[model samples]
Target: YYAEMTLVPVLNYLDIVGTVKRHLLGPRARNQVDMDFYFKGSAFYLADLYTGMSKVVFLCFWYASIIPAVYFLTAATLMVHYISYKFAILRSYRAGPKLGAELAIFGRVYIFPLAVFFLFMQADYNWSSFPFDNVCETNSTKVTDSYIGSHNLQYEYRDKDGGETNFLDNIKYPVEISEGDSYFKFCNQDMYNHSPKVFPAFPFFQDDESKWMSDDQAVFSWVFSILVIVVLTLVVNSILVRRLGASILSYFKASYKPQAITINQRFSEQSEISAYVPMKCDPSFLFPLLLCDISDIDTELIGWEDARNKYDSHNLSTDVIDEMKEDNEDAKCYCILKHFPPKKND
Candidate 1:
């Protein structure tokens, strides 16, 4: 889904009927100044793109260990993202809205690490539940306990060995006291609950039915150890991935680099700067003029020096140009914006 959302926009360079876009909303395409007024592409949403990719990242990390084939699917999805976004962001989209570094940085720093921890927990559980020649469904009460999470509501003194159980009518749910020690604990539950199955998962070294992990053991300490191990793994993996991923991207996406400011031709102040440009040499400014009924405009006053209509539009452009600049100092530097009238029809 993430890959699909990403690729669709990049590929949708042409609105064939040319009606989806409006003039004032979203980022403008590079050549939109020449395209039909309603045909320009929409702005790429970096935040939404990040959210979608993060969903894939989190899901991949959580389930990859349980089903090893998920590794390939995740790889394929991300690979699609890599190739599509690489081309689209450069060639298809505009320079785009400026975003903070933390927009991308937070997922790697916090989200990925937590995802890795979840991955470890899943991996540990799956590794232990192996050699599964014998498989059977758990009890219907537990299976049907979807919307009403049963295990969370139950209170008991025994180790969490309660397996899937039938919902006997008004029967007090049996709670395990010890290893398979099944008996009803008179707790004020709704007589329906999810009894946890005794799977030989983490924090318990299974010897026999003689012992189990209950509230008496140092469970927090063991959990702390697991967290430490997960952090260490993330640190090591991050170091390795940084070097390897850089080489990988460099190979596949040769143009992927720090978006450096590279100006091939610098602006010339004395010769090139101008408040107005004629349509004979440059026709780009004429695009805006075409949107209005220009037949009534005084054609003679367009380039005349007496054209006190110094600017147009929502009264902003002419004000700045006509303002008293900085207490009458020699105005050596100013933003030499292209002199174009704002859309009067908007």
Candidate 2:
């Protein structure tokens, strides 16, 4: 009963302390200049809007007191912290651009804290219930002692008759196990108990004591670290190269020479030949006279095939060409009649 009472106030105090620490020492906590700058920013604007709404509610008798101020301050602090954390994470990505480094930074900031919190919770639960054995046993020890020398140990096997038998005696390891007894015999029936053959209390977690990970795990870790470093170095170098390229291009553009323009006489000659010709009469008034030329040409005289081929080659309809031909004939006839009047034979 006393423990529960004590724990409640302690927990409440810890919660308050944590909140204070987050506000005062978090990434958002900065100098006066920075604080003023942030206050003028969007974050401050939102906080003010919320605070104003709260004041309006209090005036209307919906809210009690200055609790709104406290809430607004807390919300503003959390918002600033969130923004700063996001900027810091993005900055880390820009620094290296390596997947591993990005993951590591993300883990450090977000995942690691959560993991620590979970571990602390588990430890707290464990501490509340003392003298309990979990998954790992405290007394178990693996014995590797053999009667034969370490090199010759491979030849020895267990026998069915509870005697030692050797592989070189024309017997398989399994057959020897059935024929002999060479496997280690435990002194205690409890599997958790260590054999009398091995030294007690040897630290298996240490590098010096661990037989499996001392060499292989170290090599793997070293290789992984070197690879991550190389990748990060390459990413930084690539960015630098791109920036240098852009600078060089800008320099070239600034100092570039302009090419002189030269005119060609051939184009000028073609333009002169294509000059426009003026019409003799207004097109609207001479419509009927234009029709008089085609009045002499028979439309049925031209076959479809001939007309199509002729039109395709000349880029004109045969009927139009026949009309022009008739016009020329009529003009010749008129000239003959004007020059030589018809002799009257009355």
Task: State which candidate has the highest lDDT.
Answer: 1
Query: Clashing pairs in model 2?
Result: 158-177, 158-180, 158-182, 159-179, 159-180, 159-181, 160-178, 163-181
Question: Which candidate ranks first by TM-score, i.e. highest?
Answer: 1
TM-score of 1: 0.40
* lDDT for each residue of candidate 1 in 193-220, tens digit (9 for 90 to 100): 1134332244454333323334433364
Error of 2 at 288 (Å): 42
Model 1 — which ten-residue stretch has the worst lDDT?
185-194
Q: How far off is residue 315 in model 2, in Å?
A: 21
Assess candidate 1 and give its lDDT: 0.47
* RMSD of each candidate relative to the true structure: 15.3, 36.5
Off by over 4 Å in 2: 1-212, 243-346
Q: For residues 193-222, what per-residue lDDT tens digits would candidate 2 score against the true structure?
A: 323322111223222321222354345434
